[model samples]
Target: MAEFKGLSVSFAVKQKQDVQKQLFWPNLKNGPFNKLEDPVCCVKYCQSVPNFAVASGFQVEIRDPSANNAVVKNFHRFKSPVRSIAYRGLGSGLIAVGETNGHLSVHSVAMRTELRHMTAHTAAVTGLAFLAGVVGGGSTLSAAPKLASCAEDGRCLLWDVSDPQGQPLMEFDLSSASSSTSVSAPPADATAAAMDKATALDASQTDCNLLACGMINGRAYLLDSRQPRPALVLSHEHPVTCVRLAPGDNALYVAGDCWVRALSLHQGGRQIAAYRRHHKHVTDLAVGRGALLSCGLDGLVKVTDLLTYEEVQKYEYPNCGLLSMALSPGEADCLVLGTNDRWLLTRRYESPAAAAEAAEAAKSMSAAMKDPYLKAVKAYQVMPARPEDVVAPGPGRSRRPRQQLDQLDRLLKKFRHSDALSHVISKGQLKRKPQQAAAAMRELARRGALATALAGRPDVHVAALLKFVLHSLGNQDMAEDALPLASDLIEIYAAPRELRARPGIRPLFERLRALLAREIELGKQSAMCLGRVGLLLDTSAAAGGLAGSGGAAL
Candidate 1:
């Protein structure tokens, strides 16, 4: 009998490079009620409303995205610093905030008043989120929402906001279960007991029925609000900074230190994949249609494919450490990022074809607006002025002869370093020829002419050069030669204290740091391999000597 088998199919996925347009709003340097003590901690877009909320220091500010001016109204003020914020129930006009003083407050957007405030935790609240499909249904618009908050105290609490005086509906003690077992173990097996204790605490939830809490002790707990104990635990080497549930899927994405891991909720909370692209702690994550967007202290915003687990696009801002990120609920293409310096940036992606068409149209319009007389002269085949046509030089200096003047003009026509670099980049027309440009720049660096060429260039040109050098340093073929040159160039053009504080300088330094780290890690691994090989060779030689002695004795 013939047996049926399933075939696995795989395809090479081509990356999409979309043209991104960015806009920056003025920094919100001051909080609504007081001077901000820290950068904005959280920014959340309302799914059913036009406004978004930003939390910083002791206040939450609500701002309209469509407004022409950059003004934020003081929505709610707390006694302690607001560490995290989340919007509850679509179009419910309700916002929830967690504070450093371990207090949780729910505020009504339309009423502009606190609906309820409770002592939610014993320590600083690290995360706040509203469970999906728990409130805001039917014709009544006043349904109470359920909230989940986690804290440095290693506990996650679930609260029902139906009554102002009610206590937390449930609490998940992250330390209790594991601590008891370790305490009962024998002293001789202390190490084994500690390991067992850790394994017990690292739990996570696979379904929406449970809330995942990332603890400061490098463990994530999944609490079933209906049950008194945790349902599952997930462990990490570094403290878990953030936890997010994938929309419409039973998967969780956790970010801590420099890594982000995807875990399956249904498969006993097993980790599916881990991405370590960011060089610093991942500050925030926003999941979109088929991609996950992450921002980090390294000043990079990366979009990773959910299925392939590969980075599709990366964006960096100079001197800016991204602290928060939010995707517009109405538009997936619109993303708002908050920086450490209090600048809120919006990035919108447009179709590459459309951008190209717009550029072409603008160029044609400019050409048509040129002097009509010059256009007519060109159309009639009139002879334009040439170097040889000049009879005499201007008042600056004495002119020798037309031939000498022409020779001087020819010398001047030779491209400067910056101009030559630009020409090489543009030679491939719409597509940039990066390899050709990199080769030309490498030659310039070798001749010690790159610095002279870059001396008076605009900031944009310098930024482009920095990007090129970084990319070259990442190439295995060019890295050995490019590393020193790249370092020198960055030190000269980018390392000044004031320059490093510029809007775009931080990311370059971060990329350089990441490259250096990779080099160091490679060197360490190579050394370890060499040591192992030597040990094996020495062992073989000793065994051979012993065998020869034994044979001679026989």
Candidate 2:
């Protein structure tokens, strides 16, 4: 290995190699999911088997991601649109489904039959899970008959599927609790509203009796079905989109429209940490023993380490928004994704060692490869090689990208400032291309001739220039170069009473003034925050120094 600045480079090289081996390459497993008619809302993997399920168009589909010719089972007895699906735990061969309308269904996988149907709620069912031994003062897994379901009206119902009469075991109205009571101090106007819907629910892996229910109006209700009310209510600023309980820790993750926050279960759902990279709605979350996986409408799938609360890896697919995803248990399997465009995608993950072994095996068995038509063949020239018949190739060429720059430079050299300005920045009359024309303004500003250039422009040309500068000032990347130009333009145009008196230019100048004032206020706030942070650092350093001196004296 080569040394950089006389330092050994072995560690950095090894790190890079490890990263390459861990990277996952994605490929389309099946094209658009044959006969798929609607966007998928849920993709969940069975805890006891390799089969995964997808909810789409009032139907629930079960298939294996690792097989190209896997048998698929569909539940076709739904009377309403399906929203979410989950396999009943304990290898029970049962599945529960929630519908867009307020209804629930339970089906036996082997019998291909509906065991129990529920119509207890009057709004869209958002969350569904089984509470095997955690309901009605508790029982064993085989004897616990309660299945929990919640809907948009914030009503949670526990149904006894085994009781042939089909009556619910208990019902809890989570909306009755104050939305912000769990905090030390909350907003004055915080109250429970009738429309605040229940969004998601999950039970603790270690203590199955504890449940967390997420609501649409930014509240999370911690509940124990044995009681009649929520244990605690946690509040956030955005609607809770999804929630996942950690298997090994007393904490849970809640995803909202913007960020995903981790709340401490032992400390009454207080927010302990958060992660944010998605700029749109975070749609779903899946928790494993050691990692947290999230997919969002921004088309990003993030993998995070549960122990450190740090991002491990992320993949961004710009063309499609992901609605849900399921990670198979082992690395040998593949990841299944449900997209907003009604497409099911899957791809396998391979480590470097596994990939190399596969390559060697294929090379030794090249003669018996499946696609024999793709085999490499020996080739010979059909015609005799002749230098005279082959004409030398000419250099590839295209029109110059900087032709506009040349035209602007020629106009500037002639010192026709107004025509040069118009040559680049006019979108007047009907249409415009200010970007193509910004070249003229940039050159004029560099020469300190912008004032002279703008002296006698008409309303149409002035309007276009003002609009471009306004748009540029709002963007961070272009703001630095635009700041000084904007200052000079405002001084020249706004100070002139005659120009301000004109109807077209007056409104434009007022908007510029408002933007400048807002930017100034924001800058002041940023400076104040920096000062406070600096003071905090200084205080911490002084305390550390005094402690060191005391330790040395002792």
Over 4 Å off, model 2 = 1-35, 69-71, 89-92, 132-145, 176-194, 329-333, 363-554
- Model 2 residue 84 CA deviation (Å) reads 2.0
Write one digit per residue (lDDT tens) for candidate 2, span 161-241: 677666677766564544332212212332443446788877665565677788888888778877757887787667998
Q: What is the C-alpha RMSD of each candidate to the true structure, in Å?
A: 17.4, 23.0
lDDT of 2 at 473: 78
Model 2, position 452, has a per-residue lDDT of 51
Query: What's the TM-score of each model vs. the native?
Result: 0.58, 0.61
Error of 1 at 132 (Å): 1.5
Q: How far in Å is the alpha carbon of 331 misplaced in model 1?
A: 5.2
**lDDT for model 1, on a 0 to 1 scale?**
0.62
Model 2, poorest ten-residue lDDT window? 181-190
Task: Give the 10-residue window scoring lowest on summed lDDT in candidate 1.
Answer: 20-29
